[model samples]
Target chain A: MRTSFKPLAAGVGGVAAALLLWQAASGARAAGGSLPSVGSVATDLGALAGSPDFWSALAQTVGIALLGLAASGLGGIVVGILVGSFEPVRYATRAALEFLKPIPPIVILPLVVLILGPTGQMSWFLVFLGCLLPIVMQTVDGVHSTDPVARDTARSYGMKPVEILVRIVLPSAMPYIGTAMRVSAPAALIITVVAGLLGGGPGLGQSLYLAQAGGDYPTLYALVIVLGILGLLFQLGTRVAERRLLHWHESYREVAH
Target chain B: MDKLMNKRPVLWLLGIGTPALLLAAWWLASAGSTDTFFPPLADIVDRFRALWLFDHFGSDVLVSLRNLVLGYAIAALAAVAVGFVTALAAPVRWAVDPLIHFLRGIPPVALVPIFISLMGFGPEMRVASIALAAFFPTFIATVDGLRAVDRGLLDVAQVYRLSRRDRVVAVLLPAASPQIFSGLQVSLQTAFVVMIASEMLGPSRGIGAMTLLAQQSFMISDMWSGILLLGVIGFAANFLFDLVRRKVLAWYIGSRRLARAS
Candidate 1:
C-alpha cells in the first residue's frame, strides 16, 4: 500500500506540472486571446458542477455510450460465435468484415445523418459501427485460441456444438472477451461523443461543440475536463473488471501484485 | 471430396459473396428513391468515378495522405526517441509515465477544440493534432517493447562486454521489433482517423472536408463518394503497411512459428 502512494504521488505531480504549464501559457496569452486561464477554467468547472445541465448532459452521454456498447456487445458476440463455430460462415464473412473494419465509422456519419437525421439513433449507429469490429475480432481470436485438447475432450464426451461452445469455449474465451469489452468501451464513448459533436444528438460532445462554436473557451475547457474524468472513470472501472474476471489468467496473475 | 469442396471457385464466392449481397440489397432497398436521401448504387458509383477518379478529389486525397505520412513519421521518430530515453532511465520513466498515461486516456477527438484554439485553423494545427494522437500509443508500445527484451539476451551482451549502445542495437531492438511494429500499425490507423476528424471540423482540403462540404450542400451521392474514397484510402494504407511489416519482420515471423511449434 505504501508502494502505491509513490505511483499516485508521481501521477498527481505530473498533472500539477502540466497544469502549471498550461496556466502559464494561458496567462501569457491574456494580452490578447480567447484562451481561459487555469483559474477561470476551474471556476467554470465549479459553475458547471453546480448546474443541472451538466448532470443531464453527462447522463445523456453515458446513457448513449452504454446503450451503444450493450447493443454492439450482443451483436458482436453472436456474430463472433457464429463465425467461430462455423468455418463456412467465417470464410464467407471474412472479406466483408475486413473491408468494413478499417473504414472509420465517423466517415459514415454524413451518410447516417442523411438517412436517419441527427438523432440519438444516428449516434448509436455510429457507436455500433465503431465498437463492433474490435469486439468481434477479439471474440473470433479468442474462440480460435481456445485449447485444442479441451475441445477434443468435449467432443469425445458427445457434447453438441452449442453445449461445447457455451460450456467450454465461452469459459476459455471469457478473458479475451473481457479484453474486447474493455477496448470497445472507450471506443464506444469516443465515437458516441464524436457523433454528437458532428450534430448527431444532444450529449456532452454536442455541448463541447456548441461551446466551441460560441467561442466560449471556459465552457469548452470545462466540458473537456468532464470528458477526461468520464474517460478515466470508465478506464478504471474496466481495469477493475479485468482483474476480477481474469484473475486466473497468467497475464493477470503475473501483474496482480 | 474435401479438397474439391475447398476449390478456388468456392473460396472466391465465399470471399466476395457477402459484400455483393449487401450491395445488392442496398440497391434494391433504395431503388427509385429520388429524394437524394438514398441514391441508387449506380448513381453513387458514377459520382464516385466523376469526383474521385477523374477530378480534384484526387488532390484532396493526396493532401490527406501527405499529412498522414508526415505526421506519422514525426510521431514515430519522436516517440521512439523519448520512449528509449525513458526506458533507459527509471527516474525519467517515473517522472513522465503518468503524464503519458493520462494523455493517452484522453480521447484524441476531445483535444480538437483545444488544439484549434492553440494552433489556429491551419495545417500546422492538423499535423500537430495527428502527431499528438499517434505519439502516446507508439511511445507506450516502445517502452513496453524495450522492457520486454529477454533478460538472457542482455546477460549475454554483458558477458560479451558490449557497450550500452551496442546492446540496445544487437539485443534489445531486434527482440522488440514485432511489438513496435504492432504499435505502429495501430498508430497508422489512428492517425488517419484523427486527420479526417480534424479536417472535417476545420480547414478546407482532405477527404473529410470534402465529405462535410458535400453533406452541407445536400449532395448525398457526392457524400457517399467521399466516404468510399476514404475507405479505399484506409484499406490501401493498411495493406501497404502490412507489406512493409512482412518485409521488415520476416525473421520475427519465423521465430514466432518456432515458438508456437515448441
Candidate 2:
C-alpha cells in the first residue's frame, strides 16, 4: 500500500507541475500576452457550470455520438460478417471500398450538410460515416478470427448454420467487436465535435466556436477543459465496458493482470 | 484479406468492374442535373480540367502538400525521438503521461481559432496545427512499440556493450517498426483531415479553402472539382504510404510468410 501510494503521489505532483508550467507560459509576461490564465479559465468553468446552455451543448454532443455508435455498430458488424464470409461480395466491393476509405470523413461533411441541412441528424450521419470503416474492418477481422476447428466440429454435428453462427461465431467475435467499439466510440465523439464546429450543427463544438467568435477567451478555454474531461470519461467508460464485455476472451485474460 | 490470397489474373479485372459500374451510374443519374447544388459529373470534370490541369498548375495543391508533407515528416521524426525517451525512462513517462492525455483530448479543430490568434492567419498556424494533430498518434504508437520490444533483446544489447545510439538504431527500432509504421499511417490520415480543416477555417488557400470558397461563391462545379481534387490527393497519398510501408516491412513480411509456409 505504501509503495503504490508513492506512484499516486508522484502522478498528482506531475499534474500539478504541468498546471504550474501552463500558468507560467500563459501569464502576463508571456510572448503573446493573449493566452488564457488557468485561474480565469477555472473561474469561468465554475460560472458556466450553472448555465443550462452549457449542459445542453454537452448533451447534444454526447447524444449524437451515442446515436452514431448505435447507427453504425450493429449494421457494421452484420455487413462485416457477410463480407468476410462471402467471396464474391468481398471481391467486388474491395476496389470501391479502398477508394472511399482513404477519403477523410470530413471531406464528405459539407456534402452531407448541403443535402441534409445543419441538423442533429446530419451530425449523426457524419459521425456514422466517420466510424463505419474501422468498426466494419475490425468486425470482419473478428469474424475471420473464429477458430476453424470449432467451426468444423459444429458442422460435423450437423448444426444449422444460423445456430452455429449465433452460438459459436458470435461469441468468438465478441472480443473484436468490443475492441472495434472502443475505437469507434471516440471517433464518433470527435466527428460529433467536428460537425458541430464546422457544419453549424448542434454540440459542444458549436458552443466552443461561438465562444471563440464572441471573444470570450475564458469561456473558450473552459469549454475545451470540459471537452478534455468528457473525452477522458468516454475513454474510461469504454475501457470498463471492454473489460466487462470481453471477460471471457484470451486478450482480456492477458489484460486482467 | 481473403480476397488477396487467390491471385488470378482475371480477378483483377473483376475487381475493377464495380468502380467502373458505379462511375457510369453516377454519370447517368446526373446527366441533366437542373439542381445548382449537384452539378453534372461532366461539368465537374470540365471544371477540374480547367482549374487544375489547364490553368495555373493548382498552386493551392502545392501549398497544401507542403503543409501536409512538412508537418507529417516533422511529426514522425519528433514522435519517434520523444517516444524512445519516454518509454525508456520511467520518471519521464510518469511525469508526462497526464499532460499528454490532457493535450491530446482537445480535438485538432478546437485549436484552430487559438492558433490563428497566436500565429495569425498564416502558413505557420496551418503547419503548427497540422503538426500538432499528427504528433500524438505517432508518439503514442512509438511508445507502445518501444515498450513491446523484447527485454531479452535489450538485455543482449547491454551485455554486448553496444553504444546507446547503436542500441536504439540496431535493436529497438527494427523491433518497433511494425507498430510505429501503423501509427504513422494513422498520423497521416489525421494530418490530412486537419490540413483540410485548418484550410477551411483560415484566410483560404488549399483544396479545402478552394472548396469552401467555391461553395460560398455559388460555383457549384468548382466545388465538385475541389472535392474531387481532395479525393484524388488523399487516394494518392494513401497509395504512396502503403507502398512505403510495404517496403519498410518487407523483412517482417518475409518472416511471417516463412512461418506460414512451414
Q: Whose lDDT is greatest here?
A: 2
The TM-scores, one per candidate, come to: 0.91, 0.93
lDDT string for model 1 (B49-113, tens) is 88877786567877787888898999989988888899988767777877776677777787887
Clashing pairs in 1: none
Model 2 ranges with Cα > 4 A deviation: A1-10, A29-31, A254-257, B1-11, B54-58
Q: Tens digits of per-residue lDDT for model 2 on B103-149?
A: 77777677776776667678888899888889998999999999899
TM-score of 1: 0.91
In candidate 1, how many Å is residue B229 off?
0.7
Lowest-sum lDDT 10-residue window in model 2 chain B: B2-11
Compared with the true structure, the alpha-carbon lDDT of candidate 1 equals 0.83
